[model samples]
Target: MPTFLKPIAPWLVILFPILTLPLKFFLKRIKKTREILALIVPVITTLFVSSYYSLIVNGEVLTNTVFKMNNILNIYFRVDAASFLFAIVSSTLWIFTIIYSFGYMKEYQNKDRYYSFLILALSVTMGVAFSGNLLTFYMFYELLTLITYPLVIHVQTEEAMDAGKQYLTYSLSGGALILLGIMFVAFLNEGVVLNFIPGGLISKSLLETGRSLEITLLVFLAGFSVKAAVMPLHRWLPAAMVAPTPISALFHAVAVVNSGVFGIIRIVYFVFGPEIVISLWTGKLFLVLILITIVLASIIAFFKDNLKRRLAYSTVSQLGYISLGAFLLNLEGLSGGILHLFNHALIKITLFFCSGVIYIVTHKKKISEMAGIGKKMPWTMGAFAIASLGMVGIPPSVGFNSKWYLMLGSFNQGSLLIMGLLILSAMLNAGYFLPIVVSAFFKEPITDFEEHQGFFEAPVSMLAPTVILAIATIGFGIWYHFPSLVVEVVVQNIF
Candidate 1:
């Protein structure tokens, strides 16, 4: 813990929840007011996380006793380098989404309620990012599920409601698994050492026999898998696209899905430890499942005509890359996986946000409907092109950074088959993604396609977020050096 991080403690636990109230009740009818209120917390958050240089320098372990339960259920919070890393991603992007939602949802009647959900979601996400222990993380995790429900069902249609219901079921069931795992750990009654820093939690001799270890591993993987949007359990993600575009960005890219990946990371590094990850078949299992998911989801994505559904499947595949890096159980793989958690979020959210912008302006859904769309909505299509390129793992984009590490990790493992599979997956990614970009920009305009003639890329608010994220995707990708200092802070205790 660094001293600069101490400043972030009060911000996450106290000021964060306080920031949401204004948007939830009083700002319900006022879109402009709600947007203003949304800025305060995340701005504070960014300042806090970006202060990593100072925090690490001062060597302050910023821990807060938020509350406690039965001595065993201590509700504490901390924002070490690991916590700040995710916190920065979630909170920073949230500011963009909140801004984007302002204009995106302006036409909808319930602007106030929409803003409220955004604030609550951000709060819960921050809590998850900064949680000190499994118990604290679970509490915030369940809260995230509940808070984002309204965002998912924002359309208030029967379809939206169904999606919301199923979404809740998947998320809550995952949470329950996590809860059970926590209880089991508690029953073992290890002293109140709760923070989730990666590496071996206990000595290898403690659970080296690997029986209870496997059962607990199942609980941990199943719980986090639901959020990671892994295969078989990922049905809710595409269905949940009934949510507004900003919400979709929040769920798939930034807050919701990342939380799952983040949880797996915590389990691997903190709960079980990297030593445990390597000692058992856990590492092998993680690699196997992630590779299987990458190929399976890519195949499924090719058949998806619905644009959002395609993105959803691609998401599952991409999440596999993140999960795979972790399972490789090396510095390159783990660091790449951890960093990709943020990089992918930026790229995917921008892609979805662009799709939403098109839908908002032209009511287009199927890729077939987007022919010559670039002519009508140049800005949106341009942003779409860049974002899609990023998704395809092209150069000068954040997606490239994640894939670069994935490739390096694979090579480091000397796993030629996984490397080959990675290449094939990238090609598959290009196959599905290129056509959408090409259709939008290269194809001749079809007369029958409806164009809100005057409409151009939703609104400035929406367009701005998409552009910013798109630029971020490329900017971070090109200059991509993980600040050695930040890494030192984050991975210090683990490695």
Candidate 2:
């Protein structure tokens, strides 16, 4: 990283986009300039994050104090391997999402408001990623919820507003639980440092109050798991699909859902450590819950005919895989879980982008309506198929590589049941995802809707990102070393 950019690089990645909001008044005056600026902001953020790639990969932890709360409790920003990885992914993908949105939102109202909140959401996401301690994490986590609410309710329809309310109800409740859990930690330690520590902060002897400790862990897990969409808590996600496609991609694949997964990872490996968690009944219970979420979500996905709803269910199922991998409490399992963070982001985002493209071009949003649709919008459907295959854990795709690590992790833990669970989940993944591909290609195009069909495709702005991400599905899968290496470093640091 350049010395000049170093002091502010981390903050800049977040702040630059935000500062653009005020400039929106001027940018919006010129349509072409506004679009160009929107794209430039995220691109610059991505570059800034990448500039720190070597530092994070080399296992450096960068910290900068934001505020002083007292001797032991203060808000600071830190970038380690885990945060760096997430920052890069979010920043890079935000660029593509903005580009895609330009094309998708062109016909919609409140473009300025939409773009402004989008940037705010990204800023909060960066805050969550770089938060130096649990307090910092919690503060930003709460802010993330509020900032994203407008995006969730963007359409202002009855359904969209209802979904927005559900989003707030679930998210704020979960935030309260998490805050309560954090309070419990402070009480337990008199002042627990929110810093990430390898192998966790709590000692076994400190957990003598077993039930209390177990309940606290459950509170934290349940809280984070809501956004992670673990079981009954997941209804908000499917409902929130009433929002725009870019928001769906942002919530599901990039920021909102992933923050929950990242929180679980922090609680497991950083706060309580694997040894403490594994000894508690909560560990076994969490593992079981995650598995149930995986299997049940996949089954539900198989039955949903609505395209985005099915994908939403699919996000729920995939998130379970991450939690299960983390709970396995071994190096391989942890690495797999972390690796999937990136893998699933790429695969799921591509899938959502395709959904957006289809909606923009044809106004069709159901699986039943998509038969023979591939012939008209071949690139869009083709990308969708690639992403679908990746989601199913096909070899040489990012998803397969992560699942492979997860399987090995399960084997390392000597749980053949988990290994079998992977197999079953993969099959279920295919049962739902592949059918869409098959119907798009093998089935005849619905003729009653053939009123107008000739080389149909989403606009260049949207199609470009979809294709790039689709290619990335294969590119990263084939060259898995980079993500695998960083994830391995992160796991090593934590464990």
Candidate 3:
């Protein structure tokens, strides 16, 4: 890439997908053309993002300013190690999701609208990842909520519509809180541009003296927590499970929830910095709440009979680990938290993919209905079993490595309670996930599935991604150093 052209990288990545919106519309009647466009856009976007990997790994920050409305509001894009990590993970996994969608959505209605919003959501998520300032991030973040709303209600049933309304209510309320925090930041800093800095934009002297700093932290946490699915703000998630499984798998699992977690990260590490957060009481309170969410959500997950709803609650619990890691304010905790963002995305998506395949093949959604499904859909259930173990933090799976670092972080803090909560959460994780696996593989077939025979599985398109991500759950666990390298760069920059 040319030195000057490097600045255009982010714009190109964003624009490529947006440009396809019209192409998709033009080719609406041509189903083959639309499918090819949908598939190729993500692949090209991922390639473009990867081309910049060498630059990011070599410690270069690519920044572009579109324009400035004033000192306080500007349109800016930046790609550093942190943003690059998010972009690469989302874009890379998106390829698999798109491929999986081909198989899963083949019979579904509204193909054009689904693929259109789906592609548009990718652009918006990239915007969130590359945003260089609070204002920039907030704008893109709001856009993400709107773009994905249609997907949430794609089925258009009364239940789906209700979920969409609830999603909007929570998301808009969270966005409002974030906007208020931005105003506080601007007023405190005398209208300085709210650009994200490595250490923090807020001065330590101000942090120590300003009581409002604590309030500001609270507002930001509350805002991002709604989307991160932190407790009291998490009801929207379980309700939204009525969405089609691919939408649930990608938007709910990877893009939307991760964006919320990513925002909280920016607030703690980039906007406020660890030093400032560590000195505030709000940080400890937030940490305590995150621990509560981790354990409580897992307990709820154990009792849900519906598989997607169970996974929805599981997502709520797992997301707390990331937030917990970020708020710990220790290097080990931050690294673990950041790394889990990618690791958990891989594991959760695999689970969701497997669930979609199970529903398609056997029309089974409840855990009780899945007995001996392992015999009929061996490949699907095997991948599900692998992902389940990963979710439980078993060894040689990626989930274990991130959880290990989290425990180290808790130990570094010398807080036995935090460590205990994590251990308890893991046990709870096994309580819910292992039983399903055991019933599928070890128990006798239920009457409904007794007629199923051996070696049947989903289409290659759907089964391939599930198996690949399951393999990656262990593969990346063994080669943990690769992702850790990116995370170390991120931690170095922030600390």
Candidate 4:
């Protein structure tokens, strides 16, 4: 909040992670130092991002132009309510994930390279959050794909390599569509200011015929939808589960998926504005598509035996909820959508973390193989159960609160079908997620697994974050006002 910090705050948040990348190489020989540095850098970065809380809540916009290239391209940063919320959530979660990674990656090779790209991904994610314009967001968005490819293929197996290739194919294709959309925007309005304006920067005169508007909007939506994992385009997600568990937890469940939907939010509220979206009738078309993703992904998740892939499919479904809320175009809907962005991140990451612990402790990837895992890893499965319930929108877990608002938003829009879909999606959520909790707790242990005593949980570094996030699932649900405060600010500005 300091006056001098305004210009430099955003860059500092990003640089803290990048600055550690070199030290990682310099200390490559010392594993302990590298690990500690990995934990400490993200802590510092999260704190720096949190420092802007008051600024954003007070409705102040922080903009810094790092570089300007003619009129079409530039490096810029803006910290508004939306960006601040994303920056803080991702940075804060990165800390726990790094801690979890210590236990998860202890025996793995190339510790230095993994940690380096891990840190670099945080920097790039921050760039995506704070990007001031479509061009800046696009640049960082593409960088994110490149930075994460190594992580996806860290195991270097044939499956991992194939998954990496699929990831690149989907991501680069999406990026190309996004670039085409940006070029169209530039062409339609020569020398147009591309900075994100809450009400939208596209001129009304250009939208008279609505044809150009519809085409550009479709291009942008289709481009961003690939990353958003909007079905047909979501295959890369399940395939990329070949990576390590921590990567699945933080990147796939939280950072990477959010970036895609976050881009769509920018396109809707910042680039086109809600009015334009509604006026063009594109909102209805995209809303139907998102609803399909919501239901279909949940149904698909129910059948997946692999825990990570199940969670991967669940992420696809949950992302649809976020998109559904945003397109609702009403205050309650946007509020629910934006709030779910944070709530789902917390809940889903916990689920993934629990899955990681189960994998590390039992080497069991399939749900059918995890019978009675709860007895052996009580703390881990306990956390997983809580998160699973939350995912189903049960009370006293944060997921219920966001879904509540989304339903309200649907009602406000007079679309009982959307409200019905929301209800049906919750049923599907319970259908898929609740059974895992039930099987882990009640079903007898499988014959192939050795019998264990009670409570053989994962290492404290891994177990602690899972438990903490689980507690947060209920805690934040009860104390919903905390996150709602920020979401309120975001909705107020956008509406």
Compared with the true structure, what per-residue lDDT tens digits does model 3 show for residues 261-374?
999999998899999999899988998889989999999998999999999999999999999999888999999999899899999999999999999888888999888888
Model 3: runs farther than 4 Å from truth?
1-8, 25-31, 450-456
For model 2, where is the 10-residue window of minimal lDDT? 447-456
What TM-score would each prediction reach against the true structure? 0.92, 0.96, 0.97, 0.96
- Local distance difference test, candidate 2: 0.88
What lDDT tens digits, residue by residue, belong to model 1 across residues 28-93? 576556668777767766666666546644445577876776655778787676677777778788
Clash number for candidate 1: 8
For candidate 3, the C-alpha RMSD (Å) to the true structure equals 2.1
Q: 235 in model 4: Cα distance from truth in Å?
A: 0.9
Considering only N, C-alpha and C atoms within 3 Å, which residue pairs clash in candidate 3? none
Q: What are the RMSDs of all candidates, in order?
A: 2.9, 1.8, 2.1, 1.9
Estimate candidate 1's alpha-carbon lDDT, on a 0 to 1 scale.
0.78
* Model 2 C-alpha lDDT per residue in residues 151-223, reported as the tens digit of each score: 9999999999999999999999999999998888888877756676768877677778758789889999999
Residue-level lDDT for 403 in candidate 2: 95
List per-prediction Cα lDDT, in the order shown: 0.78, 0.88, 0.90, 0.88
Q: Give the worst 10-residue stretch by lDDT in candidate 3.
A: 1-10
lDDT of 3: 0.90
Model 4 misplacement above 4 A: 1-7, 28-31, 448-456
